[model samples]
Target chain A: MKRIFTPAFLLLTAQSFAQDIKPEMADSFRSSGKIYVVVCVAAIVLTGLLVYLITIDRKVSKLERDLKSLDKTSN
Target chain B: MNIKKNWWKAITCVLLFYTVIEGFLGAVPARDILNETIRNLYFHVPMWFGMMTLLFISVIYGIKHLHNGAMRSDLIAREAAHTGVIMGVLGLITGSLWARYTWGTWWTQDTKLNGAAITMLIYFAYFILRGSVEDEQKRARLSAVYSIFAFVMMIVFVMILPRMEDSLHPGNGGNPAFSKYDLDSKMRLVFYPAVLGWVLLGVWIMSVRIRIASISEALLNHSDTHPTS
Candidate 1:
């Protein structure tokens, strides 16, 4: 919740200094709050996937050790 | 599983990055109710597509298991089915959120939504069925058969039944699908790649899971042979 508001709040506050968007132009709502919603969802999903990849990497390393031990015993 | 890894993962990453930046930042059909919420289609719809594709692949692998009797095939099928469910859950969550804003309800008694829930429930049962059996080979065989049957039922729920009844979803009853919604070429450009990116990412995750399963199976075999000193 904080993450969502912080950026938007900052944008809202910083809107005056940001002269590039145009003085008479874009409406405050059209500045894309809904887009932020999409971004938040995407970020959450990607973070979850990244954590999953870390787990898989650890499992693969453990399996490699197990295989190494088995080969040593055979020798 | 043999062969050097190439650019596919790289492509998946790039495509997804493009989808996110382009999907949200890009312009959309600004109609009443839909407004900017239409952007959810790129993320939410692709999740369903990826889940369906993985489920289809899992069923294929399940059939292959029946024919060849390899534990590897069964493992692949299981991993695919399990990983596919992750995407299905994501789809359901995003869809529900999108629905809440658009339809004034987080859920409805719509036929398409009900069918989707049933599809998810059927896959959850697949995992539970996998867990119940004690014998390895018997579990493999039964899981394979169940997955194949489940896949057919999934088609019924996901594809056929919804079309036959009224649905709050598109492409059902008289509602317009993405095609009929005047999804211009610009949106299609991002939407298509978004689907491909998600499906490829599912493949990547499932492949990693299968690799781990294979390794664990090998370790089990090693212990059985030598009694792990």
Candidate 2:
């Protein structure tokens, strides 16, 4: 499938590459685009883990309730 | 109606607002040698400071929890460790970015960088250690001990590593700490608040997470006592 690159994606990519950083020395601060991808993915994964932890609290309560009801019925 | 509980949230919001404003202002103007790169110091150094602050608090809580078996202190310790990890991640990211611009590499085996990386790895193991144990009391006890160990290791790594080896980083190998020549009065103006604001923000985030954990714990306990079925 031929995927078209939309203007939005292009803008986002451009913005990420863009920086106002000036080097302390004469060296270029340019990083490989791949490194940026890796770091961004890591940040996203960490955020997702936090979201998952937040949601899991609900299921934990539900399980506890089920256990209590089972005990009640047995007794 | 609930005013006292909201203080931390209010503080969080204010600190975040200040971070953004200070960060932006850090960008607007600067002299030579610093220029835009100085802005990275505002974010990077503050994160390191916050990470250390959280870890130190965690160690204190750990000591209290172990000595007295106070669940609240244990909870505080766990939350502080989690917040420390988050700040550690931020520091690494910002430092790596700063390095990419200044050193032309995403990473180098310099003394400070190595020390920072090792400290990060040690905290990553903190979570692993927690997960390996299942008994609530045992997990808390073991993690508390380990947290103190990790905190000490962190300090040693930061303080001792740079001195033992030479590095391109500013303050290493006989280089004077807090050199006014490297860090001028203008930089200091932004630097101090940057550290304080970020440390407060880290604490605020940890407090929110801890409250959520406590509420969730209560909800679980309630379900155990009263079943819906």
Q: Estimate, for each residue in B33-76, the C-alpha lDDT of model 2 and write its tens digit.
A: 45457566667888988999999989999999999998888888
Candidate 1, lDDT over the whole model: 0.81
Tell me what fraction of the real C-alpha contacts between chains A and B each candidate also makes: 0.28, 0.00
Model 2 achieves a DockQ score of 0.04
Candidate 1 chain B, which ten residues in sequence have the lowest lDDT sum? B1-10
Q: Which residue pairs clash within candidate 2?
A: none
Q: Kindly report the docking quality category of candidate 1.
A: incorrect
TM-score of chain A of 1: 0.55
- Candidate 2 scores a chain A TM-score of 0.40
Best by DockQ: 1
Please give the distance, in angstroms, between residue A67's alpha carbon in candidate 2 and its true position after superposition. 20
- The segments of candidate 2 whose C-alpha lies over 4 angstroms from its true place after superposition are A1-75, B1-19, B26-34, B176-178, B181-183
